[model samples]
Target: MAKSNILARTGNEAMAEAMRQVNPDVVAAYPITPATEIVQIFASFVADGLVDTEFVPVESEHSAMSACIGAASAGGRVMTGTSSQGLALMAEMLYIAAGLRLPIVLSDVNRALSSPINIHCDHSDTMMVRDSGWIQIFSENAQEAYDNMVQAVKIAEAVKLPVVVTTDGFIISHGMERIEILDDAEVKKFIGDYKPEHYLLNFEKPITVGALDLTDYYFEHKRQEIEAMKASTPVIIAVGSEFGKKTGRSYGLFEKYKMEDAEAVMIAMGSTAGTAKVKIDELRAKGLKAGLLKPRVFRPFPKEEIADALKGAKAVAVMDRSDSMNAQEGPLCLEVKAALYDKAANKPVLNYVYGLGGREIKPEDIGTVFDDLFEASKGKEKPGVSYLGVRE
Candidate 1:
């Protein structure tokens, strides 16, 4: 095992520390609420000569991502940070980066999108880009955020896909926690060196990139991208396993908490999972077989694995921090239901859209979800979308 240090740091601080350890070649970012501190701290590292990163402070988030794309195309290990509107501004460039197969790692501090202009914890930002072809990882706390940031670089470079590591804005991003940080040397050794198979900087075998492809090869290229995502599942598992061996902190697509003999389960992502775990323990102590499944990786869906994990559960409750506004279930709930279709045909699955605009979700509130799940299992409560913690 590697020698590690326990430090009290916020999620943003942990992520910035991880970036300083990784020491990427280029970082182009725009400051945004909650997420600003990540790149802000990284920039200080660059200024103080702590790392040899070329920090580009752009005028807008779109320009920041554009610069990252340019730097990455030139075969540089690149990264950046953004949240909410910043992510929304970079939407166009995000697709381009993924389509071109640039391995740029991004840190996304999850915050609600603007309408009423709230700057707080929510999944609306990341959920908006769920299908943008980037691998998404959600951190439960500062420790996971730091761990995930290190792993994301390896994962992105291995699969040649952009990755987004998200921490709940203010909840994890601002909340301080004790994080076990690996030695800088260990992180460098684990991530290894970036040696791209092909890049624009290669003079001997120069190739065209971003050429307009209307119909001839667009579909085929898209198919290749699809296959890459499918291929990434095993790579994710392998990397997680290796990270575990190095530091004894293993990770997977989702975490199953007390699911051994669970009759009622709550599936969630990000910081809500932390809250759900407490309620699960309380329910278990009350002699109820309640459990929690927290998804760390949201992209690639992990449908089969998720289905397998929820196989024994009689009732399942999915908590979504962002609503899809489809008048049905939230994004996470919709996907969870789809995953359970064939395997748990008769299982009752409920959808609870909670914590929008950073509304507080407490352990007692989670207890209510389990209570509803138990009732659903008994065929008393009908499963549907419930606005949890919302005044209805």
Candidate 2:
């Protein structure tokens, strides 16, 4: 019930607006397709003096993340944006950022990685860095993109880890939608201020960063990082709950749509979940118990919670926009299967890799997934990976 501004904004514009409101101390970014406008619009804010920020126009995404690391080490709240190749180039620095425990926030427009030179919506880029140790949050549309960006700041700072907020390229990035934006004052009040316990700026507490850790103590540091990630789930949930109380939109690890009493369930992320919801409704109208499970947080995967949600379903299908290419299941599917291995092992779980390279996934396509789930439940179809919307 917070005071808000109703506006039609593309996902890129919404992310940029959220950045303007947060007004981090530093933003070193390189422009890339779909994600370019996020930093592009923020740059204009810098030029117009709307926010007091040091906008560094870096030569490449690698340098952008490098610069962000330096700024963050100096106790400055930092953020940036990138896409497919941009994210790939920044991959090396990404590991360093998270290992060093820098609270840097990144906006990643989810685009397919290139080998054949494609620029379109897909989760490949984000999934590529799944183990890089950053908290990953996916947005379903423009509104979630905006809200996630705002909440990401708090999550990163609270956990002292880097965070990546992603939106499917062009799908959500270019699509405009009516969004309820919270007032700037509310956003400002909600985030509060950044106060680092140890930073380069603190002369009295000077400490070495990015120091080479050899076999002597590297293991302990890595273990601590692992524990931190394990501990971040609560931080993520708490911040999401607080943001909801302030903005009237609550978020969680994932969304379970019509899961109660559902015999067939399809799990997905990003904009695909929106389409799946429609299909679930239609199936319900036809007297089919279909449902959808949409994961908002990919990293620090909510294994137990996901297992619990799918426990009641007779059949579950996990839809992934990117394939693992390991001749097994897609990334999201693999996670879902692993989650159900012990808890819901008896249930039939299917994997569907769809919409790669921005191929459209219609409501009918979602219905097809549900159909497969039902068929698998009845032991008519084996549970495994199936490429959807592809010429097999």
Clash pairs of candidate 1?
none
Per-model TM values vs. the true structure? 0.99, 0.98
> What is candidate 2's TM-score against the reference?
0.98
Off by over 4 Å in 1: none
Tally clashes: model 2. Answer: 0
Q: Write one digit per residue (lDDT tens) for candidate 2, span 97-146.
A: 99999999999999999987789999999999999999999999999999
lDDT of 1: 0.93
Q: Which of the numbered candidates is closest to the native, going by highest lDDT?
A: 1
Scored against the true structure, residue 39 in model 2 reaches a CA lDDT of 96
Model 1, range 110-213, lDDT digits (tens) per residue?
A: 99998989999899999999999999999999999999999999999999999999999999999999999999999999999999988889998897879998
Question: Each candidate's root-mean-square deviation in Å?
Answer: 0.8, 0.9
Model 1 RMSD, rounded to 1 decimal: 0.8
Displacement of the residue 273 alpha carbon in candidate 2, Å: 0.3
- Error in Å for residue 247 of model 1: 0.8
